[model samples]
Target: MYNTLLLLLIIPTLTSGQPGKCDQTPPQATVLTPSENKGIYTMTIDMKSKNQNIYRPDQTYVLIVTSNDVKRPFKWFMITVEDPEVDNSSYEFDHRSVDVGSLKTLDTNRQSRYSERCYNSVENTDNTDKYRVEIHWVSPKQSDKKQRVRLRAMVAENSEVWYVGENLTIELGKDTTKPLDSPPFPPVDSCNLCSEARYEVIFKGHWSRMSHPRNYPIKPDNNGYSHLVGASHSYKYILWQEGDKASPGLKKLAEQRDISVIEREIINAMSVHNGTRTLIRGKRRDHPYMFEPSHSLFRVDRIHHLFSLVIAMKPSPDWFLGVTRFELCTELGWLESHELPLYPWDAGTMDGISYESATSSTQPVDTVDRVAVGSFDKESPFYQMNLNDLKPFGHLQVRRLDVYPLVGDDCVEGINEHEGSQEQEAGSENVEEVIEEPLIQAIKQDPSLQEDNCALSEWSEWSKCAPDTGYCGMGTQLRSRYRNDRKVYFETYQDQEDFQDGYKSQANMAANCRQKQDGALIESQNCFVDCL
Candidate 1:
């Protein structure tokens, strides 16, 4: 009896001082099968984990299985615990791999392939030192969410195992039935068929005029047509899976072929939060500026409008002849009474307005007389471009195109019209449109009306008539003011030919000029005020 009492005391001491569980953690897992899954592929995995100390044959846990791939890192999720006690009803159990009808095959277990796997495995006898589970089947294809047969295992550790497979589901996607790289473009109709390189160059040539943070690319869902280089609805190009993300194949041909393609986004507009300015690229005249490959969040429908103009000039004998085309893309849904990025009045200044300031009282008229849209020859130096070699990710076939041509003073002819003269006495419009009468008609014409005519040597004596109204009077007024401002500040504008560039400079000038309190020309609070 004394020995037994000594043994009981010794047992308590040994239990308190003995080494505890060495393999208390679960095992790491590795999936070995299913390198690819498109049709009838199978998935298999080998997992190992450990548990020690108290061992109960009835204790159960679950294992979650998952995989990593290139297109998608994780695709499947499968559970290991199949005990009736573990409610598997909450799981997304798709039995597409189950055989039915004549496709059924004889199985010793008579259970569907996917439901055939044993829930748990014991290392030896009724208990297990580690768990290994495997499942096989084909995923369902009809769902829009593309829920695939993914695998992610979790073991309850008998303690943590209950919640391991709960609320775990793998997202699936449709198979790539038609692989890319099959020349997914329409049949060519013209010589050279405008290769992707040429298309990109043309797109660049026309995309540069847009000023962003004000003239951003519109979202496709936005109402109205896009007027910028690549903003139009029909202006999308193809995405040659292997080519640059900005390749012109994805844009419309007319837009991709034009000379310029740049637009602006406004940071602050009225009380509506437009976020910040983003430069959207790849838009064309009369097209919708729907999507910008560079900036994904910018949507056209969220904005009010987009404006674009293209000017083409030719040097004539008397003046520089030019054709200017203006276009606007607007929406009715988002328009409000609040101030907007000024259209032409404020936009044409090219010098004085800050994108942050919305108080400028500039109004856009229907006409813009100073700017013109012009056609260009592909061979012209302005259209000439170099290849961009260092594109990110070894993409973006950067090919430079010619900048738009700038018409000089020699090619410009100012119109002169008499005030309120409606009758066409000597009908000749501006100097650019004036036609010279034949010398023979002047010499042989009736001598009475000869009072209006002069000698062949004095052909300049004949004066042309004026129209009832001035040429786009409102437009002329606005353009004249802008031109006068630039002319008066010639010293301030050495190389400032661009309207937007000039406007930025003007914004700086206004900030520096200040009202003096004591006849002193000291700097005022304009800079600080402007910032505020």
Candidate 2:
């Protein structure tokens, strides 16, 4: 009786979970497996990113184990990444590992595997934190082709009751199919391709997360198209072309988003390579942030009507999207209003699979090439076989705004209508069609625009009694924090932002930053004339 009482007294201080559980099969007996008693509780296993359900074989991912009720935190858990191809043992009692077709010939008799993988709740900690546990699992690299791996886990509310989560199957490969590498881009219509003629045009860039939904590279921070750099020059000059090597200037712009180098190339073209024919001055406009269309005014004459422009993709690997060698004038007439998808093109300058992949220059120089939908290679960020059509990284739409004088202060070169001036096409019935610069300006100046983007920094420190005139009667105090501060102040940004990790404007990013100097910080408060 003393020995029995001593055993019960000492067990509480030992390791968690049932003892001797590490030993699978007993001498000449079957291995005992636990049963999943459900109905009263629920549990689930999920991925952290939640962007893609598919994972590359052999890659490591974070799996989150969660329960529906925070009040019932899991007291113990066991997880396994299994190859479904292998068969597990059958037991008269309902075993989830067998029901889900997993476990797969895994030897449960191994003490080391069980002792190392099983976990139990700790003392003196928030049980809620244990409710959501992150498990890092590495997938099997050599699973049979097309076979998926099943993720199985069991969570115990305590030693007496437990819940077995449904099996989550992850495809061994990136995807079953891939998008086309070279989608058939229709050739430009109207052959009258060029001449000494000129026309003012409105260039609209629609670059958004919708077009390039593949955040797998890295969720883009700047989250917008870089400034525009193009030339209104003769065919004598080429900004970039498919299957051709990218120039040093073009390469720099694609990889670094630096337009100055390419701008110099346009300047040099007039002095050396493609003289006077390169009529368009190499200038870039301010980038549009958060997917807003970037509109610019420019004129291309017949002599320099052969237009081509390149705009970089933020947080990309030497990728840019734009029109190439487009002759504004076709003998038929100016291609009035032309809208086309702007497929991403690789400068072949940087070797990377995603936007934030470490920069590794391609040696021996790779030729510029178009990005095709990588439906097969799950690793490539551009893979889109899984996405619906009509959505890509971006698209370009240009409409003739009006005819420009051969020699004018504007319209002959690339320019941003910063003054919010928009020239409408003459004889056009649709006046509202032209992007109302005034509306954009008003939106920028309007405080209401804050709601969509106006997120506040974490609540500021509560302030002390105000009315310093004498903190005694009818006094009030308030604490304030920043809103849209990242783009408005905390930094020098008229439009775009660049951060090493990512560029999305988030409240957390500016939690410690303030716009106190610029008057962008907004205070939240409530006060009454009558005070205690």
Candidate 3:
């Protein structure tokens, strides 16, 4: 049996001198799911040179699964291709191996699934005690125009530990429309013809003192924020770094709410430096209090995986808050959803002791810093509060909307069809060797190891309104626990927000956290209540 080289990641949009988006060489590039670690392995093509990056439609190519961290070995994995325009499973694997005595599963009704690696036997396993393997893929013929495809792979260390591999992407078919200047990262940038993915940026305000408006500080009557300004760039560039003096663009943006300042910077980076690819902008919200949750949508590609954004506080002394350089991709690919705590920062451009302080103090500090105490007077707000004691002024939530072909223009933002989703079944497999079950004893383990024991860390605090999504959404309360010691579990509580769709969004995603049924302690998490 040939070692199945099962990777087919060509790449996503890239900046000049940056690694391929799907290529694992640059690190932290792709993932099937969002997580802290970018994983140690990724898929790659065994091409002789960079020119072979394009798939010439109908040609058979050899795919390989390689790792960056060779010290970390794995046992099982799942791989597939996603090309919305084509059948995902139609891109078949070259299964010419001769072996059996494996688990039998029903495939697409009567069709059996292809060979899945396990300790089937010494000779039949795809690879054991190894760091890499090779698989084959037969590319489909081009139809009318070229379309992009994503090769997603999932690597697991047993059932409980797995890293989502960075996606391997490549364009299918020949681009005959115009002779391209060059392939991005090699020749030039991929034309911004279509957006590869969509993410919803939810800005949740948490500035209220003691959770009550009647508290000490009065809410500003003219409170609101300017449009959110951000960029999607490679690992090499940063929109604003903490500790360093803010860039001319960022300095102007934070203190003056001038988005054009950063817009020019992003355009220059894309054209001259080749470090950034997309310039992201959102609409301005002008309303009283500004504590209510608001959201905006932006598009992204694989190469430009790191995100940096900044927004201004309308009434403070050059106070602002936003992520510096947040990573958006996981080992498997881009995240489905993510959230972060947001604290206020002092842009160091002006001096003031209160929200209504000097508008033009005109004293610039050496570097940017967080909001800190300038006076010990009790009348001065947040002066006594340590940087840690000062609760987050707001929070940021990112939820993926859609990816490629299906996502390009403005219409794709609020039109996500998450309901009625289903998975496709598999087809028949061709195994040449078969051994009776009685001959090969199945490896057994402790029953406690397999039971779905309730294992978890402490429950996280209930999220503020606009819990999981945009608009007045429900408050989310989540806790990370291992289901059968593997999957992350969550429980979101109520806070009176989005009445129409919030309940629907929660129904299919989380384990309900509620009181136990009378005389039935086991039924605590199984109950459902109407949010109406």
Prediction-by-prediction clash tally? 97, 15, 25
lDDT of 3 at 223: 62
Rank ordering of all candidates by TM-score, starting from the highest: 2, 3, 1
Each prediction's Cα lDDT score? 0.20, 0.46, 0.46
Per-model TM-score, in order, reads 0.18, 0.40, 0.38
Output the better candidate (2/3) by TM-score: 2
- Per residue, candidate 2 scores C-alpha lDDT tens digits across 316-430 of 7898877777666553444566666666788988887766667788887788875534323445655433223335555566666555333332333333212111344343335
Tell me the spans in candidate 2 whose CA falls farther than 4 Å from its real position: 1-211, 216-219, 271-288, 384-390, 404-532
Candidate 1 at residue 522, lDDT? Answer: 15
Off-target runs (Cα >4 Å) in candidate 3 are 1-196, 209-219, 271-273, 359-364, 373-379, 404-532
**Model 1 CA deviation exceeding 4 Å by range:** 1-41, 44-398, 401-509, 513-532
Error of 1 at 297 (Å): 24
Clashes of 3: 25
Q: Top TM-score: which candidate number? A: 2
Cα-based lDDT at residue 119, candidate 3: 20
